[model samples]
Target: MTWTDDDPGQGEPPAILGLAKLRTARAQEIRRAQDTLTTASGDAGVGWQAQSQTAFAAEVQKTAGDVELLAVGMEKQAAVLTQYAGQLSQLKDRQRILEQRRASAKSSLARANAMMPGGLFSEPTPAPFVLAGEEDSTAEAKAEEEARQRAAAESKIAAAQADLRAIESEWDALVADRRRVDQSCSTALEAADILGAVSSFSGSAVSAASPGDLLDRLSVLSAIDLQVLLAAHPELAEKLQAASTQDVATWWNALDAEHQQTFIVGLPNIIGSLNGVSALGRVAANRINAANRLEAIERTLADWKRQAAQPGSFTNATSQISALEDEIKYLRGAVSEPPTVQLYLYDKDADRIIEMIGTPSPETKRVVTYTPGTLANLDGFYSGDTQSIADWLHKRDEDGMVAFVVKDGRYPQNPLTEANDQQYARGIAQNLADFEEVAFTDPLLEGRQSVAIGHSWGVANITVSEALGAHYDKVVSLSGAGAPADWTPSPTTEYRDFSYDDILQFAQDIRVGEHGAVWSGRNPREVGFAHEDYYDAPLTWKSFPGNGLVNPLLAAAGGIESHNLAASTAPGNLTLLNDMRDFINEAGAPR
Candidate 1:
């Protein structure tokens, strides 16, 4: 029970001490069993009992080996407990020192007050001494000088008391910290003891095999074999799925590039979609799967072309070929060479990417994610307008890094039909929120201001995400369609922009039953939610006064065009972008 800095058992609780003793006992028992087995195996035996004795000895040796491993693990757990206990002791000692210093400060302040002329609490008073036969002017001058000196002395006393109070406050904080540390140490010791006991029977034992051997075997497993392994041991898969991102990243980095490629290639489905897998790993796995898909599609297209050329082919191979060609083009574009920006979290199937025009690392002061409206797809995600908006933000604030992401949600082939589906918006919101969670978890992106820009359907998605408790510093909805009736934007700075002539807002009004049965739910513009601000864009024709004479005839056209003007790189949209940027910067300003 004696404590020492170097002693592994020092400062450990009684429970840990008991576990340590048990481990020692088990180690000795294992050693004895091993020795007896060795002796029996070497002994010259005869008859049928020899075979039985040898088998029994082998079983005993195996059991002893497992027990020895368990004992070693328990010993490590005990050492961990002892280390935590040592930390607790040191914290307690520091706490005592701070308390002593605070007490000394208090005593010094008391002594300082005693040494003062009157008392620390006494008010200043003029001296009683008055010169006899002296003029009144002289007496008044002496009284004024005495009063000034007393005031100075009182100020010094007050400063000394303030310093002592500050010291006492610091000491109190230190004591609170010490208590927390002590509790944490206690919890650690208890956890270690419990885990140690569980470890003894937790079925974690592997045949004395090297980890490299297991990895090598895994590297050669086929997709079916891997799936079977997953099916057979889902608990292990669950553990891998729940591991921290850093841990998964570490594991992924340890493998050589070739092995990493092979491992993921063999089990792309699992690795690509597995939660808790590092973004880097997911990107790599998805890239492989994307390539495989492209190759498969190309082969199919080649086959179709060959069939279409054959004589008397009754099937309409032309349409099939056209569809495949379009798909190939889109897929190729998605994983195309020389990417325009840094891509993170790319899922070809879902066509969602947490991309960045500028680095979204910790060094970046601001990170903005832009969700595009209806008909947005990977093929058109990097259009000129998208790049222009990203460039505008980056140029506007040279000191800050801005990333515009098009987190396209799943939509049907015909987007118009799915535009009002709240369920679709909710699903997209979940995806965006999950991406945010993963992004913020990175040490480099921690605490950075995050803004979400939603255009058309994106507005609904972002709104729903916020309502679902997604965190955003600022949200800007451009021509938002509507939101669920019961949903409200999360507590954050929100901005809404709508064109005065935009027919889409009017159309959404009809869809949401605002003018007539609520279609969607509530138009964000009419929701009465206290938004930070709203921008109303003029619906003038791009030509303006030049087309004024015929503007009335083109009014509908101008309005229809204005719906997209807010989010576009069109000259007229510059005002909206500037206003949005101002709002974003204002919201992020220090309170």
Candidate 2:
């Protein structure tokens, strides 16, 4: 079923407000249980104490339920956030690479221009040498001298031509690089911005006063929160239900089927809210407009190229070309991309996945282990998301295997809940250990080489396993959590850290156990997304901003904005998948 949140009638609603309320409810239940337990323990009657114990048991179950729901919400939210961040990171990287290439081209162009015109290699005019009383040289001697001079001049001219040609080659290379970089950077940055904006919206939901407030902010919901909110405010839900449904459906039909499915599963609130649908439509329209602008500029460049090919057309085309480039660059910066979601597939069966990903070359045996941070889902799969990476690797690497392990082995049903930060970290570790055990046990994996790629929580999982004595070759963590003081990596551990958000619980938790020791002591490659930041020049969410729980409006805005950010660089995410495949091929390790 296509679920959408683009209905205008639904109004702006918080994406994760319902889950937050669920967490709050669990908290309340826990508090109530404690109170009853305390009172019962102080009572004289055993029967009353037993009753209290039973009640506590029931409360605990409810608490667990709440926790599960909340965890689901957190997981979903985390998935959305990571997807956006990862895509943005990719966009930033591509843009930087492209810009660097472009800059080199510009430098080469400058040199070439100087050499070609009246600059560096310009031919110098010779002045006649007239000695005061010197007789004129004989005609025959003068002619011979003139011939030699002519030869020398010709040689100098040839040399200059060669130099100019070399510079032109450099210029051409640079131009190509610049074009690639520009296009890639533009697309990626736009995607990142949109997703970032959505994330900003959701991030604000952390402090929503109630689920209703949050739902109102999301401006879309036909499920859970809206249902709950409707239960609370029957009149409002009833009044808006019919219009919201139609509006959401209409909006859903406008999007691609895949997107439609994603919207429903990930953004239930939007499906029920007409306003959310409208906002989403507006965002989509903006993305389309940006695409159109890019296309138009591309056409203009093509026309310029055609005109430049005509005799004397360079003079006319040059200035226009420069102007067009400037305009494209600006438009690229301005355009926003659609939101993207990451999908992480934990492939317990690597060989099959490997074959599924790439062309068949040989019967290869390999292992792939994936670990991801919070908020993962099947719904939010995108180009640069971990799953996309895996897909790329599968297609590109003919012989490699792949696998994934979710943070805490917990894919919460809801995307809103205070995470059991410790358990989540510990669980991923357990997952890795289990994989190792399985690898050793399986004939296919026995003696087969493997690599582990972890991001955020996944990094913790791999580190924890290594601490507990698991083995793997080349562990890469993308934007991993915990500092060197938190996770120590030695011979078996390799750390690749992405510089992103500040690590909070990860640092504290890794400080707890011997695993904590491992967490605290690893050197990671800290690559900054500054490349993208410099290019896209990310801005904070303007419409909504605050602790998500405290502000419904911000939370709602964050969700949409983050989605856009993730989507913008989604193409690069797809490229990453190819990189993964290439990595496998280069390693020549069987999957």
The lDDT per prediction is 0.60, 0.43
lDDT of 2 by residue, 269-302 (tens): 3242223243233233334444565797799798
Q: Which model scores highest in TM-score?
A: 1
Residue 504 of model 1 has an lDDT of 66
* Model 1 per-residue lDDT tens digits across residues 85-190: 5565665566566567767767766755654556664445555656787678777876776666666666666876887787667656655655565556445533
Q: Once superposed on the true structure, which residue ranges of model 1 sit more than 4 Å away at CA?
A: 1-271, 277-281, 310-338, 341-356, 382-397, 400-408, 412-417, 494-500, 508-521, 528-557, 586-591
> What shift in Å separates residue 386 of candidate 2 from its native position after superposition?
6.5
